[model samples]
Target: MARFKTKHTEWLLSNMAITVSSLLSSNPKPLTSRPVGRPPIEYVNAGPRQKRKLASDLAVHQGHNTSLLVHAAAVSAEKSNEEDTALVLKNIYLTPSDHNKVRKNLFTQKTDSVRLTEDEAFFEFVLKIAYRLKLKKWQVRDENGKKEMAKQKNTIQKKMWNAMALHVDKPKQNGNGNTNDGNTARRAFAKPKLLAEILGLDENLIAYFNSILIAISCHLPIDPTQFKKYCQKTVTLYMSLYPWFPMSATVHKVLMHGYQIIEASILPLGVLGENASEARNKYYKSDRRLHARKSTRQKNMEDVFHRAMDSSDPLVSSIYLAKRLGQQNKLPLPADVIELLESPNFLYPCNMDNNNNAPVFDANNSDSDSDSENPFTIEIDVEDDF
Candidate 1:
C-alpha cells in the first residue's frame, strides 16, 4: 500500500545530492574514446590549476568558433536569400558532408538505420564531439583514485550525516544492519539549508538545489510560470557545471514537463501530493496489529476495514478532534520557499511562537455524560473458535 509517486521526487533529490557529493570528491573517467582524426587535447594528468587554465583557453576557443559559425550563417543566408531561420541555422551547423556521412551511417534504408531515431542520431553526434573534447563520464569515478576518494567521501558523508541529524531522528539501522544515521527521504523533506555550507558547493549549485527543493515540496504552492523559469535556469546551471551528468528520466520529466503538469492540475499541486496518504500507513499497521481479529483471515480483514471506516467517519472523527489538542508550533518556512509561492499570504499569521508547551486535553473538560468512560479506548471482542 506504499505509494511511490510522491516519494520518488524526494528520492531523486537525495540521490542527486549523493551523486554530486561523490563526483566532487573524486575525478570522473573519460566517457568516450578519442575521435580517430582529432588530435588529443594534452594535459589529461594536469593539476587543478593547469586544468583551470586549459578550461579558460577552451572557453575562448569555443567562443571564437561560435562567432565564426554565426558570421558564416549570416553570409550564407544573405547569398541564398533564405528567410527561414531554422533551415538556415541547420544548414550552417550541419555541413552537407557531415549530413551525408550521418545519413549513410545512421539513417539508411537498412533495418538497423530504421531503428535509429533522430534523438539517437543527435546523441551519437554529441558523443562524437564529447570524444573529441575528452569529456569525462558523470557517473563513473576513477577506479585507481578510490583510495583518496574513499577518504574524501567519508568526510563528506560525515558532514552530511551530521547536518541531517539536526532535522531527522537517526535510524537504528539503514536496512543493511549498519547504523547509517541519515534517511534520504526524510532529509529531502527536511531540506536542510546548511547543505551548501557543509559540502562547500558553489553558490549557483546551491541555488539550483534550493530551487529543486521548492519544486518537490509538498507544502508549497507552485506557480507554473515561475517554476518553468527556475527550472530552465537550474538545468542550464547544472549542465554548465557538469555536462557529463546525463539527465535521468525522472529529472528530464521534472525539468521539461513539471510546469505543464502543475498548470493542468485543478487543485494546488501541494494538495494533490501523497503526504496524507503516506502518513496513514502507520495507523494502518497499528490498527492491523492491535485491533484487527485473528480468528479467521476474513474476520481479520473485516475488523480492520470496520476500524478504518470508524476512524474516517466524519461524526466520530469530529468528536475525537474536539477532544484533541492543538499541534506543536511549526518553524517558519524558508525565504526561498516563500519567494517561489504564488501567494505568500497563503501562509499568513505565521506561527512565531517559541513556546515549547503544547496544549493538553483535560479529562475534566469532557462534554460526555459518563465521567468514568474513556473516549480513547477501543473495545475488541476475541473469538474463541480455536
Candidate 2:
C-alpha cells in the first residue's frame, strides 16, 4: 500500500503542471456587476418617448402592420430596386433575368410568338450541326480500331478544312495570352455538302442541310410551299435518327420553330445575315491593333474611328471593289443546290459587265459526279468498328 501510494504521488506530480495550465487557460474570470444608479432627468423623461419612436421607425422600415402605408411602400420600392440591381453587370446591358427570358423565348418551343433573327438561326443551324458531327463518339474497344477511327475522323476534318479554304493550326492566343478553345473557327470550316457524301449520312439529312444552304444563298424571296416541304422532311428525318440523342435548344429552334420565324421576316432571309457585321468586327480588331494610336484611349479611339471612316468611304471602297470581285474564282453550284434555290439566276448574274463572271451551274461537273461515287463512305464502317 505504501509502495502504491508512492507511485500515485509520482504520477500526480508529473501531470500537475499540465492540469494547472489547462485550468488557467479554460476558466475565464467571472464578470462583476455594476452598481445601479438613478437616471438623469433628460433620459428619464425621454426614455418612454424614445422607445416609442424607435419602435415606430422599425415598424415602418420592416413593413409591419401599421397605418403608415406610405413608409411601407417606400421600403418595398427600395427593396425592389435592390433586387433589380442584383444581376446588373458592368458593360453588359442585359440583366440576368432579362437574358434568361430572351434565351427561354429563343430556344424553348412552347412559345410560338418569339422568333430567332435570320443571322441567329443561320449560325445556330450551321454551328450546331458541325459541332455535333465533330464531337460524335464512336463505340470501339480494340486499340488498333480506336487508332483507325481517330485517323479517319482526322482525315475527314482535314478535308472539311480544305474545302472551306481554312488552315488548321494551334488555337490563337488572345490579349490575355490565353488560347480560346471555342469552335467558332471550326463552324466556319463546315462544308455539309462534302460531308454528306463522304460521311454517308442519311440522304434526308443531306437534303435538309442543302435546303438550308440554298435558302441562305437565295437573294430572292423564298417559296413558302417548297420551304415547308423541306422543313417537314428534314425534321422528320432528324427526329427518327436522333430520337435517343439529347436534343439541344438550337436544334429544337431549327427543327420546330424555323418555319414560323422565316415566314415572319419582312426582308429576304439572306439579306439579314451578320456576315458583314462579323467582318467589320475582324476589321475593328485589326485596325485597333495595327493602326490606332497607343498613347491614350481617346487618341486611339479617334484614330480607329477616322481609319474606319476612310476605309468604308464609298469612293475608297469602289476603287478596289472591281479588283476584289475579279479575284474570286468560285466553283459551280451543284445541281441539287440549284434545284433547292428559290432563284438560281441571282447567284449567276448575267448582266455583270466583267470577264470574271461567276461560274455557271454545270449539271455534269466532275466534282458533283464524283460525289455520287465517293469512296470515303467508310463512315458507316467506322461507326460499326466496335
TM-score per model over all chains: 0.46, 0.41
In model 2, what lDDT does residue 124 have?
A: 42
Q: How much is the lDDT of residue 130 in candidate 2? A: 36
Q: What is the lDDT of residue 8 in candidate 1?
A: 77
lDDT of 1 by residue, 307-349 (tens): 9899887657765453352333345454555556677655543
C-alpha positional error of residue 177 in candidate 2 after TM-score superposition, expressed in Å: 16
Full-model lDDT, candidate 2: 0.56
Candidate 2 to native Cα RMSD, angstroms: 24.4
